[model samples]
Target: MADFDVKPSVIDRVRDRPRRLQRLAVLIVILGMGLALLYPLLRDRHGAPIEVRDVPRLPPENLAVIPLAASPTDDPRRVALGRRLFFDARLSPLGRSCGNCHVPASYGTLRAARSPGLGDQLDEFNVPTVLNAALSPYLGWKGKITSLADQLHRVINNPRHMGSNWAWVIETLSADSDYRSRFSALYADGITRSSITDAILAFERSLVTPGAPFDRYLRGEFGALTSEQIAGYELFKDYGCIACHQGRNLGGNLIIRFGILEDPFKDGFFDAATPKSKRFLKLRVPSLRNVAKTGPYLHDGSVETLEEVVRLMARYQLGREMPEEDVRRIVAFLHSLTAPLPENFR
Candidate 1:
């Protein structure tokens, strides 16, 4: 070897240039494919295309909840597959399905105040309904997540929710020929973490229950709501309840601090064992849709009856304890928010 002759000749450098470029190109392709595969697992963090408040001035309240929307792309085949995935128990490590807490019979949420999770632990926050959840600005009781796509990861991994992560979820789902076939039909990647979550999102977005009497009333069918219910609607706006709770899904679009004037959590509503810091504030105002059926109410499932829920809202959100009669009127109005599932969904 020449001691001072280590440098390659210009010809040698030129000859190696294409090899270097080829390796770089291969690396780029590998990385791109890896990202395409990984996109679903990380997609939840992308937030929403439009912020909750930025959603185009929603159609008239009645027109907001249209018949179950034909998925985002209006693909019936994809949405149909998603429906099966939505109810499949194999999605979880413990075999408890998403339907375990959000039963369709009870309007996408269970009757339990705080939904039961794997083992004996009850979820810390209430299980909000999947109905119209896509319209929500944020998901979770605290409104931490922004879009339905993002929340799927949280739900799948949260110990109190699906109680499983991609490791087991992917292997389990990938092993099923039927599930694999469904995923393949809908997604080129097939049975991936992202595809699985996306399918569920499609199904959930289709879960909207339109044609409720209240929706009809909003559509100019003046007689859809009763005299009492109409009066209750008046009271709802008069009391400023509409401020936080008025949107396509009523309350899901806004985040209202749970206790503006006073802390409902400070009262006996939450168990003393629960942390005091988590008690109240910045909570996603839940949708009033089908609220009558989705009880016990609140993030903790503390209140048992809708009547009491009205009274508590008056005391906490409004800072004035409402009279039984006024609460009665408001409860009647809230009932108008309930809508039945479209026939196909039912």
Candidate 2:
């Protein structure tokens, strides 16, 4: 072979191979770490990092809130006291707190279709979310309860529900030093039946979820929702869902018969063992605000998913079966109604 002198530049490049490799490794590691850090955010329910800067500056016209139930006493002291009492599981006969059935992360409703209470007795009806409770006139499926206090009182007294009575709940709270202090700050008379229930009611009234994509859309930020979601909204209005599910809280303001077309009680919505009555009896239409999270839909919570809920609603309420595509679009629209509760709630 002929003798050849390799260029100094080529020799230096060959010698620096390790340094280049190190730099390449460092770049790869940095990218991997960045992906690892971003993975959790990728799992966010919104599917994207919230862009607060891109939010609309002006509220949409024709957007109005329909107050269904009156807000609990706005006294900061009272509201604060109520907030504590709400999560106090000690008041229940069992260890389960108010947050048990109505979970804050689940938009104030538990994941279960029917909540098990006190031990053997399960809540026969699906537990409704306490969120936006203030926007409804009546509480419960029958729509008989008039106020939050009344709702609290009913829950506490129901052996199958709270599984605790007024006397036990009051005495239990009174014995707790923390509760005693909280009650004292809010009530002059201490933790009585009225005070205990009042505190819980006040806290529940504040469980409202706001800032949903639909709310933003209604507020003139038309960009808040995806085209699929907006299509669902149109189907919602066109299909007459807006008749009962209109207003800010959407459906919380009205009481409507479940089976306007066919009696769902035939499916045993209310204990099939019981003799069927007129299926036209009204139920307090639940708020759709958090329906996406507050699943196992309807009063009985028989339907497990929102799509099934939509199917049932169409067949039973509208007397027609919706197209699968329509169901999907409407379900997407319903998801737009889901908003996070303000901070310090959960």
TM-score of each: 0.77, 0.74
- After TM-score superposition, the amount by which residue 143's alpha carbon in candidate 2 deviates from its true location, in angstroms, is 1.2
- Candidate 2, which segments miss by more than 4 Å at Cα? 1-73, 265-274, 278-281
Clash statistics: count for each candidate = 1, 1
Candidate 1 lDDT tens digits, 1-346:
6844655675577677867787898999999999999898777555554465465565454323332222355477777777777777888878888877778887888877788865897767777888878767778888889988778888888887888898888898888898888788879898787887787777777777666677788778989988889888888888888787776677776677788888775687668776777766688888787888888888888889999888888888888878888888888878887777644354
In candidate 1, stretches whose alpha carbon ends up further than 4 angstroms from where it belongs are: 1-73, 343-345
Q: Relative to the unseen true structure, what is the C-alpha lDDT of residue 279 in candidate 1, on a scale of 0 to 100? A: 64
Q: In model 1, what is the error at residue 338, expressed in angstroms?
A: 1.4
Native-structure RMSD, model 1: 22.1
